[model samples]
Target: MRALSPPVGLPMLAESDLVRQVARRLSDAIVQGRLAPGAKVAEAAVARELGISRAPVREAARLLESQGLLRACPRRGFFVRALSAADVDELYDLRLCVERHAAVAASRRLTAEARAALRRQLGLMRELAHRDDPARIVEADYQFHRLICETAGNSRLLRLFDGLASELRLVIGLIGRLYDDPHEIARTHEPVLEAIEAGRPERIVAHVDHHIGVAWREVARLARTLSPTPGGAA
Candidate 1:
């Protein structure tokens, strides 16, 4: 039987941090492909590996279930959620809508502090890409877009973006190195930031649409490759 692989060099969790730490470790496993689609997440094995009790592991799985990373079964326990091409398509569709509007809003409301924050995030993405760390790069990529949503000055829009966070992370991880150079991923966002900085609503909308639309098409295509059957989860 395949065993759960504990994340290397992680310290033992303290009492207060058990559930969140377990959930984060499990989430890292899922996003990094250590836990594959539809694979059973054995609570016992995970607890053993993490040197924790079954209770925290169970609670962590439930948390991940709410995040759409795992689905619960009555007797069989939790399994990693399998995403279909349709799932990817739908997810990006929502992102395109949310981000396009958010970018337009951000362009109008661009503050000096917000601009610096976005630039800092972009720099971080470039550095992470240079180190060839895809997982962290994916995270930085999300933060770049998330910053746009936050700068939009709409609490509800930011909330909408937050809701899609985990599933977006999962799908991007599954897509795995969307660009060959990894630096290309960072490069693609340059125009979006430029458009925002320019404070042109039409330019912001166009760039945002193109950026997300490109990813949407690529992710959908790759998802279909990963799971061949029409609308079938894998």
Candidate 2:
């Protein structure tokens, strides 16, 4: 079994909270590529590394499974879920549809507060871009788009976007860097926000399409090379 990094000491908390912490550690490993795609999650090894019982590790794996980040085989236990280029393309297609409509709706219902929030998020993305952490950068990027969906005030749209979060994060993590410079990734959203501020539905949709479309093309191309782990194992 591969040794996994232990998270910070577990705080005194309820059983559910402990499970959540374990799940977070595992999820971080997946996002950071410490745990490669299709790698089996040795529950006992993880428990030993964290100095905890195996029960919580098992439960956490189940939680990750629900999030589409891990898969549980009949007798092979849990392994990181593997995604292919086609999967990446399809996921982005759904994302584009949801975001295009959400951006259009947000433009119609744009509020001062939401506008400020989006700008702050953009600033955070710019700041994080200069750093070496891809996960934080990707998170900031996701939040900016998420803000648009929230501003749209459509619960279903937001739910759909949230549903795609884990898989999208994994795909971006695999691609490593979407643009030549991380700042370029942040800059792509500038036009999207500008179009929204202009309060033009067609313009907002066009910018959203272009922003997401470019990422889709790049990620799909990269995913073709990485592909999925054969037989769902490394």
Candidate 3:
């Protein structure tokens, strides 16, 4: 059982908050691969389809633009930003640093209640698997990792990875990989979780670092495939 972090609260939105609502919807779509890599975004069409004005949609596009999810084109609309090998490497490297430390710190604080909470998340993921819904599987995996981060008791670490997680979703999709392959991810995680629950901090770190290696290679592969040869970055 590990100590998991409590759920984060939503920040207060202004009285007039259409822009944020639009932004959040688009962000969720992008993260889930509903708006996948290299897809063109028609602002007017998205606005029409979503039944909102273009102003909010445009603002939403811009929000993702700064986050490296969308790229603006002159005299054209936005397109999903492709990840370069360098970009993927950088993203995963940061993930490794943050997750490694978080895993170690969290392992030291494992509690019985936390273990049950994680098992619940895993069961939910298994249930989502019955439908073969990749997106749901990915979302569940995100929550599962969030559970690990929560146990680390580091707010800043979770916040840092939160941003990375969205882009990482795109990376996973690019590789035609789901965030959690039930058996594979389970194998990788079970060892770490077991080690953590058993209070073997050293073995816990070993299992975690080993599991992260797969992600590192996947990102490296994606970075190379997304390089300037096909279509350069925007």
Which RMSD values do the candidates have, in order? 8.0, 7.3, 8.4
Q: Write the per-residue lDDT of candidate 2 for residues 12-122, one digit (tens) a residue.
A: 357679899999889878887788777889998999999999999999999998988998888878988877677877899898889999999998889999999999999
Candidate lDDT scores, in order, read: 0.84, 0.84, 0.71
> Which regions of candidate 1 are displaced past 4 Å?
1-16, 228-234
Kindly indicate the candidate among 2 and 3 with the higher lDDT: 2
- Root-mean-square deviation of candidate 2: 7.3
Clash pairs of candidate 2? Answer: none
lDDT per residue, candidate 3, 78-153, as tens digits? 8878776777778878877887788888877778888898788877766766666666666776777788899888
Cα error, candidate 1, residue 145 (Å): 1.0
Q: What is the lDDT of residue 116 in candidate 2?
A: 97
| Candidate 2, position 198, lDDT | 100
* Candidate 2 TM-score, true structure as reference: 0.88
Q: Candidate 3: misplaced stretches above 4 Å? A: 1-17, 32-34, 172-187, 226-234
* Candidate 1: tens digits of C-alpha lDDT, residues 1-234: 999886554344554378888998988888887887777889999999988789889988999999998888778788888777788888988888899899999988999999999999999989998898877987888888899999999999999999999998897786554667888888899999999999898998899888888878887777666532222134
